[model samples]
Target: MDRTLLEGLFRHAVAQAQPALAIERHLPAPPKGRTVVIGAGKASAQMAQAFEKAWPGEISGLVVTRYGYRAECERIDIVEAAHPVPDAAGEVAAQRLLELVSGLSEDDLVVALISGGGSSLLPAPAQGLTLADEQAINRALLASGAPIGVMNLIRNQFSTIKGGRLAAAAAPARVATLVVSDVPGDDPALVASGPTLPLRGGRAEARRLAALYRLDLPEAAQRLLASEDNLPPEETDAVFANNSVATIASAALSLEAAAEMARGAGLEAAILSDSIEGEARDVAQVHAALAREIATRNRPFPKPVVLLSGGETTVTLRGTGRGGRNGEFLLSLAIALDGVDGVSALAGDTDGIDGSEDNAGAFVDGTTARRMREAGIDPQAALANNDAYGAFEAIGELFKTGPTGTNVNDFRAIVIR
Candidate 1:
């Protein structure tokens, strides 16, 4: 029953961020000329479908989402591609997107449905850079423990359709961007590297960050980062004259919904934060401390309370791990909370994936570690090898949600009773 309740909190967070529920309310009016919709993200396909149903006039366009994340659409075309790592399919789609937005006039409208994962789903390598170059750098950044903002900034430098380049191509055509923000600050400019929004940093900033993180970029990627030509256009450029952006859904809003759900269930609830970011294991330790405090002394909150938080966390790969950030977080948390009674927790990526695994995340209580030990699994050893997924899988404690069709970031909840 505690597991069910904890999962309920996560579901509430995810449901609140659904594009179908939020997109129509934020959409711009239909244009007098052509209305072209172009989007990329885990939620873009659903956004297109919702927009299609809401529009009163003719509309046509394309959107790209992660493979197997495709949603059915009639007027707008939905394309599936690789995520976290761009692919040949994404490269072809990126080229096509630039062409679609070009040759348009002020009478036309470019509706950009942007969200997290869009940055990777549209992998248009900039001039002199190849898709392979982008992919290698993207992989490196993911494992470097760099924050999402820095990662996106670096990716923006290597893309032909990001950092306001997409909107620039639609010059003379008004752009209306609706976003599902997944970054720490909910900066629409950082969502999917701000493909339709002008994010003002350039090659210099990217190079500085790359050096700071010791990123190993391919020769072409390194050269591109060092070149003056790789900088994004100025924010005051005329290309952005008639553009507008709206954050339709975000981590803060999602966390609020989860908190409300807890309250509705007659539990006193508190939201710790909606924008925490750092190494996953480190963040888990902080969360465990909070949970321990509430459970042992009830100083922060009374018993029968649930604490909720939302944000993206990073994983610096040190071992041959087979799990994502949330998995790493849960394993560390379980170890810290071991044998502490009446405290249970759940952490999941709202998009229904916790790293590369099928599980959204996992569930844990004070008994989690002891249970693992009983099953002849050393929890600490598994975490050391970055094998949290394997540990949880061996015990059938994995939490799987196929695809929630939306993304607001990570949803974490701790229940103490």
Candidate 2:
């Protein structure tokens, strides 16, 4: 298998999902009156820049993005904040965004650029809850191995600006949200905890998820969830009447671009699914088995074929690993393959960061396991300790692409020959 070709396919997939390219056509026209843009996400700053370039009239607003993911924009003020966890900077940004669009008329328009990571980038705790309280719950949720959908549900319950509350705040104005979907199935309500989309379930579901995950919520958070004082408003409320959402970019588009690249390289490509979900290591094991079958018996597809898939995966974190889900997936795949010939794979987050790690993901070939063993590193032991990053770093197989300025979710490709 050509490792260079496999890496090229992954790069092409990420390029296809770039916010600058995907957000242009979906931009709404300038409103008749004032146009105020407010958003929160890793891609939001880039999305704001793209909107400014495509927009004709003068527009002004503020958006919060993960620290180090900011894009240069003249009109829109880009604020950097913590991601995967909320901090004081995010709380301030969320408050300022709410104030920016507080009392707009029907002639005004609110273009909210929401994408992945917004839930953490724009943290506005509910009336009774504090930022530290929200932070505690968020930290627990990240370690709980719950899917993005359920995590966002819990987030919305404790946020003042999430679950359509941002749009509701700008009640009389028309709210047009341009979303870069990072969740499975491209559910707008799940992206960035759906600041402009309505809540799915009420506080009861939030409580159920917390109990199911055994999250030890803070006193204030527990009180907020238990009481009806700060629950999200009904979805059918009049505030949502003029709110609309458009998914400009998603994982499916990136997967298709990858398939086209594979075909161009004289290899057959199959996109298994763009909405795959589950534990990272378990998913990698399944892909490894499929690759083995194709390389040996050819049941699924012939040799010289690339299998591609997208979607986010979770890690339960039972150990003190220093890697994200992508690295964990590649490490597990290497172990399952066990030096089988003619198989190579790459797994990464399109946003150029995996979990809390600095690398986008990692790469592995058939000899990955053998190389680790030769270096006196036990692959199984590493996997057991959730130290995929350490294993990959020792073998010099980490893939680092700093801040791709967009996010659809995880990207995985297995090349069998």
Candidate 3:
């Protein structure tokens, strides 16, 4: 249970979750006619490349991904856009994608590659709403501390392409969606707002979410919500519907792979939960307690145990700090596990980029507190500023993976001996 072994386990888990291998193996047969590939998400570009390799016939279309995640695709055009926030490029991509599917006949196939960040990558604002308005709304939502489910629910209400609307636009054509699910439950409707599915909920949920989050709706959005057209279901066919929605990869799957790897390395492994949610700092405290239990009392588990969990956590934006959710979670954990022995942990988003920062996440060994103490950095103060990335960077503890070209939410592993 040395530092190198613990770190290797974390890296192994991340490698198992990369989209190239995991996502490429889940392809369905290319349609008899033209196969029109369309997608949006952090991994859509990588997913598109996989589609080209697996398809038997001709394929052409577009898939938008977060900046720096684009892969080379001959027939399928790959577009890069902003994530966690919508941009004009995404707006254009959404319009073009809608156009691409609109002309497909029943004989054609619309292979929709979807994953996390699709909501922001494929943002085509509803009529009367501008990209700026959408951006403002998105900024507000991210800052509101709402869970992904609630945030996507609200997003679906404001977009013309989300919440199954994309599937509707490709009516008559057979549509199959291949997804790398980043959501807790892997619900088709919740992953990137289920672009290839139909909206099933009413506007009431969106209305309640806005009010609950104290979000100020623009006039255009408010007007649309009041209208009857809000979240109206679009017509779609059932051809190849049985296996149309397939989750090629998920956070739980990645975590299990990590746990197995850890066990093989002579460490007892425990997977806490893959659907953990709520505040990042709060979740870290709970994880810290579990680490301590394994290190000392061994009440729930014995020594030489590695605790693993996967799920998206939220930061309420209390301070103007720079970091993603994973970094924040590690900072909080480091504080809680301060001066504790034989406990080390790594928490990071499966996607290389975390939140608005470029770092994947941060890692903390048993000496994290000691290192911070020597540097005169207050873990508590850093946590308060939501500056986990800053603190970790100052101490060279930030984990940087650039872009793994996938998104399956967060991966957290703690090894205690």
Candidate 4:
């Protein structure tokens, strides 16, 4: 019953952060010239679909999303591509999005439906760089376990369209971006690397981030980072004179709904934070300590309460893991709890996909570790191999929700009863 209710809370959170409910309320008025919708993200397709239904005038555009994550849109063209890594399809989509917005008049309105996963979905490499080079840098960053913000900063230096370049291409036209933030701070400029919203920092800042993360960037990317030409447009640039941004959805939005739902269930709920960021295992350890405190002493808020949080946790790949950050987090939590009674938890990406794995995430309880041992699964060994997916699957506990068609990043809940 705890697991069922937890899943319900997760679904409710996703529903509250959806673009269908968000886009209409924030839609820009119809432009006198034209309304061209262009977007790139895991949720961009759905945002476009929503925009189409909400707009009062004729709208035409295209949006790119990860393969198998596409949504239906009658007037908007939906393109499928790779994610977490760039591909030829993504490169083409990047070029096309720029072209579609180029040469627009001031009377025209460019509505950008932006969301997470746009970084790789629209990879327009720098002047001398190639898509493969961009892919190489992305792989290194993902493996390095750098926070999403730093990774995006480095990516902006090597991309032609990122860091507000997308909005710049549609210069003189009024650009209104509807964003679904997946970053810790809900900065629209960092979502999907801010294709439409320009970042404020310069090349110097990008270099500092690259060195701070010790990012093993490709040769071309390295050169671009060294060159002054890699700098993104300043906040005062004329192209941004009439541009606007709306953070229609985020982790905070979902977390609020989940908290309300928990209260409705007759459980006291505490939202730790909507912007939690750290290594997955480390984060789990901290959360476990809190849960332990509440269970053993009833210190924090007492028993029969739910602790909720939402953020995209990074997983440092030390081994070949079969799971994403959420899996890693749950595996580590299970280890730390080690059969502490009266506690159960669920952690998963709200996008319905956790990292590169099919399962959104998994469930862990006080009995989870014991169950793993009974199934002949070494929880510690599985974690060491980064195989949380395998461990959960063997015990029939992998939480699979498929693609939810919307993304507000990660969702977690701990029910202490």
Candidate 5:
């Protein structure tokens, strides 16, 4: 298998989902009054730039993005903040964005650019909860191995800007949200905790998720979620009737691009699913099983075939080791393959960062496990300690693509030849 081709496929997937390419066509026409753009996410800055380039007249607003992911924009202000975890910078940005949209008229337009990582980029803690409290809960949820949807639900419950409150603030004004979906199912409400969309399952559902994940919330956060006083006000149907959303990019679309790239390389390609989710190691074991079957028996497709999948997978930290779901999945898959010939795979996050690490993910071939063992590294021990980053780095298999500026979650491609 050609590692270059495999890496190229991943790049193609990300390029296909970039905000500059995806956002232009989906942009709505200018409203009768001022157009105020507000957004948050990994792609928010680039999305803002795209909007500015295509708009006929001047537009002013603010957008927050993950630190180091900011793109240049003239009219729209782009602010940098932390991601996958909230920070003080994000908190400040979120507060200012709410003020920007407040007191708008019916003719005004609120163009919201929402995407993956927005939940963290826009952290407006609810009353009685401080930034520290929200950060504590966020860290717990990330370590709890909960799905993105469940985690976002808990985030929305504690946020004043999320759970449709942003849209509510723009009550009389029309809200047009342009989204780049990074979650499975592409549910608008789940993307960036749906700042401009209605909450799917309210506080009750959020409480249920916390209980299910066994997350211990801070005292203030606990009381806030339990209280109904801070709940979002119910808006008339007309308010929502004026709002609209357009999904410019998504995991499914990126997966299809990868499939097309595979076919172009003269290999048969199969997309298992775009919404596969669960524990990283578990999902990897399943993919390994299918790859083994195809390699040994050609049961699913002939040799020279690639299997692809995308979605967010969770990692439950137990061993206090360097971790990222993509790296963990690749390491686990390599272990499961156990030196099976003619098999190579790549797993990466489209946003070009995995967990808190610098590397996007990693690559592994049939010899990966053997090489690790020969290098005096025990793959099993490393995996047991949740140190996939260490294991892959030892064998020079780590993949690093700095700040892709777009995210649609994890991308996995297994090539069997």
Candidate 6:
């Protein structure tokens, strides 16, 4: 398989994972009373648009998504906000979303469109805790390379509308959550930090995670977590019992679609796993080794094979680098491959944003090293500084698909021919 063909196949898979189409298939019927839609995520806008198209009744309300990810809907309002960190815009949007569902009756319908990036995009800080406090802690969490679950656990405790609080606010309304799974295991509670389900962990766990990661959290956040009043949602048929959550799409399904495309192109395709998680660079090194062994000996599946995997990867910030997990993975893989022949790979986040960087991820071919050298970029220095974006930009090969309007996690494909 050539580099062009591999890129085409990867792009095809990404299109199939878009939220608008996926959300359409999972939408339920319109509620008996007013149908109010409220959600947060990178794909929230697209999800709302799909719901509006599918529903038969009057739909109104708002949802928040990452900047540049907004979609058009005549009845539903779309709000854009910052991601990976909470912003004032997100705080106001979150409060409005919660307010929309405040007086919903048992007959009312509250559709929560959940997806990746929602945790940061929807910020309703609890009483006595300012958005600045939440933002500070959020910044610390992102820099610490803590797992998404751990980070969200802390955020949920300090928020007025996360970890089942959204449902709690909706009182007697019948709530249904339509989520695009991005985290490993596709845990509904972890998806969008479980705005409708009962939260399990508490401040003790948050403090333990902070200690384990050595993160410097805000004093207000620390005290809030330590407070006895900080507790998870309680079980009740009215709120917890009536709320229904369903995963509309996930990384595993997306990987399967990609595998099918590869097979159609006459390449033997294998999906390694969908729940992969770890440091981005470390995972890339391991994947590179596997590809090398397979290419050299054909032990796994022989030549003309495409090894595919999907899942979110984390990066522990050790330098002032500007790249997402996909970029970091490609940098590490390039080093591991070390000019090896007959291997071409692409790693990228499905959401079209890698970390806070502009590009989703980078691609590497057999001659990627030579291309970097030709471009006069120091590949080793770039990797050390976490400057995958710079290195790939110099080579004119950075993957630039802006605002895919979806979030499943990372997509990686290694082709050996």
What lDDT would each prediction earn against the true structure? 0.89, 0.90, 0.83, 0.91, 0.90, 0.83
Candidate 2 runs further than 4 Å off: none
Model 2: per-residue Cα lDDT over 1-417, one tens digit each: 466987798889888878789777887867889999999898998999999898888799999999999899999999999988889999999999999999899999999999999999988988877888889989889888899999999989888899998888988999999999999999988999999889688888888988998888898888888887767778889988867889999999999999998999899999999998889999998999999999889977988899999998898888997999999899999999986998998999999998888899988989999999888889999998889989998988889999998999999999988
Model 1 TM-score, 2 decimals: 0.98
Q: After superposition, how far is residue 350 of candidate 2 from its true place, in Å?
A: 0.4
Task: Go through the candidates in order and give the clash count of each.
Answer: 0, 0, 1, 0, 0, 0
As a whole number from 0 to 100, the lDDT of residue 202 in candidate 2 is: 84
lDDT of 6 by residue, 1-417 (tens): 266766776677677767767776777667779888888899888888888888877888899999889899999899999888889999999888878888778888888888999889988887778989988878888877777788788778888888898888897988888888899888878987888777667678877877898878778777776786656676443567767888988888888888888888899998899988888889988899889988899867888899999877787887786888899899888878867888989888888888888887878876786778789977888887888888898888788788788888888999998
Model 4 backbone overlap count: 0
Quote each prediction's TM-score. Answer: 0.98, 0.98, 0.95, 0.98, 0.98, 0.96
What are the candidates' C-alpha RMSDs? 1.0, 1.1, 2.0, 1.0, 1.2, 1.6
Regions of candidate 4 where Cα sits further than 4 Å from its true position: none
lDDT of 1 at 126: 83
lDDT of 6 at 256: 86
lDDT of 5 at 385: 91
What residue runs in model 6 are displaced by over 4 Å at the alpha carbon? 235-238
- Candidate 1 lDDT over 75-128, as tens digits, reads 898998898888999998888889999999999999999888998899988888
Q: Which ten residues in a row have the lowest lDDT in candidate 4?
A: 227-236
Best model number under lDDT: 4
Candidate 6: the clashing residue pairs are: none
Off by over 4 Å in 3: 22-25, 234-243
